[model samples]
Target: MQFSIYSKPSRKKAWLLSALAIALLGSCGKAPVQNQKPATEVKKAAEKPAPAQAEAQTGKVVVYQLFTRLFGNSNNTNQPWGTIEQNGVGKFNDINEAALKGIKELGASYVWYTGILHHAVIRDYSAYGISHDDPDVVKGRAGSPYAVKDYYSVNPDLAVDPAKRLEEFQALINRTHAQGLKVIIDIVPNHVARHYQSLHKPEGIEDFGANDDTSVEYKRDNNFYYVVGQPFQVPKPQNGYQPLGGEAHPLSDGKFEETPAKWTGNGSRLAQPDFNDWYETVKVNYGVKPDGSYDFDSLPADYATKSVQQHAAFWQGKDVPNSWLKFRDITFYWLDKGVDGFRFDMAEMVPVEFWSFLNSSIKTKNPNAFLLAEVYNPALYRDYIRLGKMDYLYDKVEMYDSLKLVMQGTGSTDAIASVQQGMADIEHHMLHFLENHDEQRIAAPEFAGDANKAKPAMVVSALISSSPTMLYFGQEVGESGTLDSGFGDPSRTTIFDYAGVPAHQNWLNDGKFDGGKLTEEQKQLREFYVKLMTLSATEAVFNGAYQELHTVNKTTQGYTDKTYAFTRFNDTTKVIVASNFASTATSFALTLPADLLQQWQLSGGDVELKDMLSERKASLKVTGDTASVQIDLAPLESVVLKF
Candidate 1:
């Protein structure tokens, strides 16, 4: 059953519940009296040897996504539609060694530097030989990062010197690598800005649609589809909206000239797309004709089981469409510059064949490159990972959606077990996250209304499987995305305007890269994230076998729908995780199923359970096919117990 997204407790109730949660936060890891056995007795019982799995441990990946333009900006002058000089933009140089070191300390192996690509911003850079973007087509003063204007260049606004933007980006990449962390950037293959241009393209490389026969609606080699005889007409302003908050600009006359208009980024074939359409960008053509027939070669039926090298060799001598070749070259350019990988935007909108060709090429250059995609459909997850050769796909539809429901108090923790069991075959390929640029922050009023409420959910998302865990920049310190940034509404961190993240700024601490100004609660929250993330990345158990205990413990004493339990074990370490999603304290007997106990070869005895994140200790009683621990969980508390 689907849970209602809008269902929430009353504001007064929520505030009181959250306050109680914060007050009890210090005791979340405390051991219960019933389970707190003598140290001598617990240590003696824990000395019994357990069987170890023969399989070698694989390391888990932890990703930190930072909005490049906002991460280093210290400005709190949050005036709506403010100019760059007023709002202040963070430069590439601002992400110094100290910043990289700070990120590394969070146990992030890869840093996804978003909005590094050149996009259609409202600001003029004619002096730097860049053409001006019309304010009518741009989303906001800063424009959408997905509306890429140039594939071969970095955003000029991100550099101290606009003329040396590429060099500055390269230096940042170097700094990231120096900190023992890999770098990731965006590669939007599905579409491009309506006014696409490539001033710095390599010799003999033509810009998109440069060689197209615009008189016709479709061509196999054309980079974009056309609307035939219709010229482009901008969508009328809706809800009393105007460019740059009604401020007058030279290009704010609600006019952008495009003869023989192309299809919009969302595949809207109309020359005059609806106001809600993605009107700022145009879709790219990848040999799919107007009649919905693919003109390009399809992959072999057996290619699903083949390696990336095999897929690359299959297209070695075969001719590809111009759009495919152009994207391949664009990716190669970044890979050559030491960029570790790409995060493809709206990947499912593009065909699987293009991904097979492009991703295979990327693997040929850097076999270890991280290729993540945004694929929301559950049925296409396997196809995208197996046939398309993607390294990871956002686990939004199942994992993230279900967890959000539980956190919002509209769903049961039982639903999480079902979701995990269903995706067991491909769990490792799924990437888990609580927040991104596109989603509402956990601490936002529209969501859980308190950052502390997400602690239990974060635990399950990060440690439930072998998948990578991604954390947004300010999520650690609870940056509620409630600001009314220009052209972007509240409840999500804005990607379409210039703004400073207030909570992130507290940790940024005026370029000191310290949490000097953070409150006690925020500091504790960050410390919890550091410990959890570091374990997720370094612990071998996270990369090993997982068994759900929630289903078996349903009838156990004090176990309710609001509580969940699970275990992760490998050759060397075994852990039990218990979480309480309720806004009040809970007491339960967390159980270990007979099958799992058999796998670990613990027949019967007392076992020591040490809280990994705190100094609390507990005792597990295992009696002939039955093993259980009495657990006490505070509001929104999650404990990782190691035996």
Candidate 2:
């Protein structure tokens, strides 16, 4: 979701918005037929699914974060800078039962469907009563999914019937549940698309910035910040750029008209934002004072110890902020449609107190609702987890970064212990993942340059702690992410443009949802992933106690900086995990500490330990107060030994 973190924007390009298409770009150089639903039928719920009952059956979550716009795309015409006409987009209908079954076979319990919200795109939906978005503000022929245009409607590009998009999405949700998979969608509360118009808002709800008092720069009740006596002007294209690759349109004149310009999404007050800024959207206000003070009441000191009902009652009669109510209503609307959870985008940008109100209300309604937040600050991790009532936060800076360093052969295996020990108190709240939409692909040249290198990292990320694990759509199939996607480079998939993923398309196998076209190496890599995921989901020891053997074996004979070891066990099962991050094969005697031996009640003799990843058994030679196993590991290999 970030545009080159290391690259800073110059003053000239800071105000320029990357111009895209003014009309919708359908795949295959042909306009898709738009089906219309009858006006009499409306999307309504039949009955609520009991989440508590479902949670009892579903132990831990293994999320497959599928980019909805690109997941089912089968097009292979990967012409660089190609329009959507050349590279077709995936629709909701493409997520058929076979697709869900394929994902389920990968041992996924939940599907995080990204980009389901109705965002501002350069599509000409004028025939369906929807206006076209200006290419001057849109990111690509498609649009940035984070720049939400409507809070109540589903993206029309994802449905067969444009008018019945919400119903089609509901059917998708139902189908996902039929395969025993829960659905999670993104909720961007920090900002909305610049042309924020909710065409399908409920009867009583009003659109954002509609009733704002535009005379002043800041108001407690206002939804947006305005530049007094100023008019909005589009920034001039930079770096030899032109809208839609020089495609001309009447509205692409770089002359957007806005009297009393509003603040940009990144809090820039400039009348025209540079291309590097989040200019396509506008920031939302939550009653914060101009001097960085709170304008509304703060939470009481003892709010953490209160019940959900008590927290809900605390704000019953109080005059809360308007923005808070709008967000709460939006969440309620999604929950009514059977969305099992939400992944809040840039959640740390907003105040944590609002999350207290919003998340508490959500948990009150469904106690098992998954609330995952994108928070990167280490200092605020505890506050967001305990006070904000979030279920999980991304462990990116610590575990993911450290593992990436190990994958690149630049870091010591000893660092994994510190990352685990530091988060010991709140480890369950830290969600682990090697690849997401924002990070680089594992097989990309900028990363490890190989997907097999992710095995050890995936082992620790999934089984080291009792937290949830996530995998992006193509991570399992070794997607190199080296495509010259229009707006996005090769290291990451294009979220802003329309394109097909190469490796993922191979697995799509012409909509068969089977790995019919995969090579031998790719098929083996996928099988390794399937085994890892299945073990993580079905193992009893995954939820048990954790102990680090890496610290003890760092100085042991045959153990080097490229190796790591750990153990997890409860009363019934004891599992030992060992990994080698080196490029060459090595043999080592994995010696267990005396404390671990006593914990597992092992005496000096021979014990059988089974390797879960390779399904090979080995005998552990036990001495007086310790146990040791002779292991031969392949390059970048990891093993899970169970007794």
Candidate 3:
């Protein structure tokens, strides 16, 4: 279900957008049309019906993150919801057409709208360092959908009638099914929009210093333990910031920074409670201005509140709505929405008890719901999986290190060995990706010169890695950007590179903004990816555990540095993944281990490698004492061969 991630102005050649179309290049697709059988049953016609067949394996969940503001499908002009000026672009009159088009184009497993809720008041809409005007960021008619003033209301900018959004959304989900895709939506659980109903009347609420809290700072681990024996502790705000109470903010007279969540540079380590209040401007607390410089964090965290139990007298005696107070309600909401899983937002901030409670309840509704956390450390990964409670977290350390080695022209089994080892017990729980929403794109703007090379290499690594893959919006489709130091560009991402942009649309008729040219190369790569993913879905080794097999080749630069080989073996399947990152050809000593020698397979040309990438042949050969493979690693080139 994983789709293309590439999206942007950065392209390789004129055919850059058509890159993923490699699957269809000089080759046939998997029975695009089934052969029609004769009307009369002549083959095995007399036989009686056999027993029912068992169900096939579960399907992978494909999630597409939609940037509503940039969807420029003008075809919906007279459809429904009135006309919506998406950041001053053409208006969308209907949602169904867009939905239908998205399914037809992306072949997504799920359609995920990044933010669609409504906010009564909106002043500040900046996320990371980017705003709506950025080439990739869309400045819709309303504002940033993240700043939700009303949870129940869908942003009219996204779907005109707030009441009709759910229906359209359901239709979109149905359309996804029609294309063999699923649908997912983002759910922010940590903090409500600053202008939440409770914050509507901030005049009556108690306001304390930012990051001010009554929390008793515990020694090393001085926070409430969600579970009985765990050493996990909640983080307390350093600057004494306390959470707001009871009332919400009033109708805005000014910007959001002045609202309750605003923080001054007054203290060092202060944590702002609300991300943004709808009324006046409030500075959402990010990292602190350090002693000499500052620290930019990808995932931001705030202090945890006293447990609902500790304040026994406060809520125990009084009556509070369980729907509003109970944390488990969040899990139930997604379940009701038919989500297959949740990719937790800044999970470290949410207590483990929340997960334990969620895991227990989620299974009751749907035994197959999966949960993935987004943390980037290895040690924490051990604790989460070791305890057998949490699902998976980010493994950036491994990815970063591996990428660093690959870029530097040096790599080893030891480079990614540790993480591979740690994944032993929880392979199914692991979530893997080359790039995601929070981080910068893998192919940085540096690729303006040569995305041709950057893409193949990057794609190979992502597809062959050992984890349940998750891709940020445009990666599979070749979205090239890298904004690590600041918030990425606003309009720089391709949330709109979808069904609206046809591969053969006339550039003159559609105008440049319609994205007709963007998919030219990516479509090739995406189709290739589809074949690879479909193959991976059927191949146990690709989705399961992976191990590295060392090759002691000494002559070629890439034979060692340019090659990446992995072996995935479980009780039933054994898969060997070998890749070369060098732009040129390389040679591996044709020495097969005892286990491999026993299997009968062709060498080099004799053994045609059906690379999952584009379902094309990755040139290779087995010669005397050496098996030679001429991989097109012209620059950032990569290929995965399975034997």
Clash totals in order: 0, 8, 81
- Candidate 1 — worst ten consecutive residues by lDDT sum? 20-29
- Candidate 1: global Cα-lDDT? 0.83
Q: CA lDDT of 22 in candidate 3?
A: 13
Winning model by lDDT? 1
- Which stretches in model 3 have alpha-carbon errors above 4 Å? 1-55, 58-63, 71-108, 117-148, 198-325, 385-390, 404-414, 446-450, 453-466, 481-520, 551-558, 568-575, 595-635
Ranking by TM-score: 2, 1, 3
User: What does candidate 2's lDDT look like per residue over 174-259, in tens digits?
Assistant: 88888888999999988898888898776667788888999998886688878889998776666776666667776777777678
Q: Judged by lDDT against the true structure, how good is candidate 2?
A: 0.80
Better-scoring candidate (TM-score), 2 or 3:
2
Best by TM-score: 2
Model 2 poorest 10 in a row by lDDT: 19-28
Which portions of model 2 show Cα errors greater than 4 Å? 4-59, 305-307
Kindly list the per-residue Cα lDDT of model 1 for residues 311-412, writing each as its tens digit.
988777666677888888888877777778899987877778788989998999888889999877677788899989999999987899899999999999
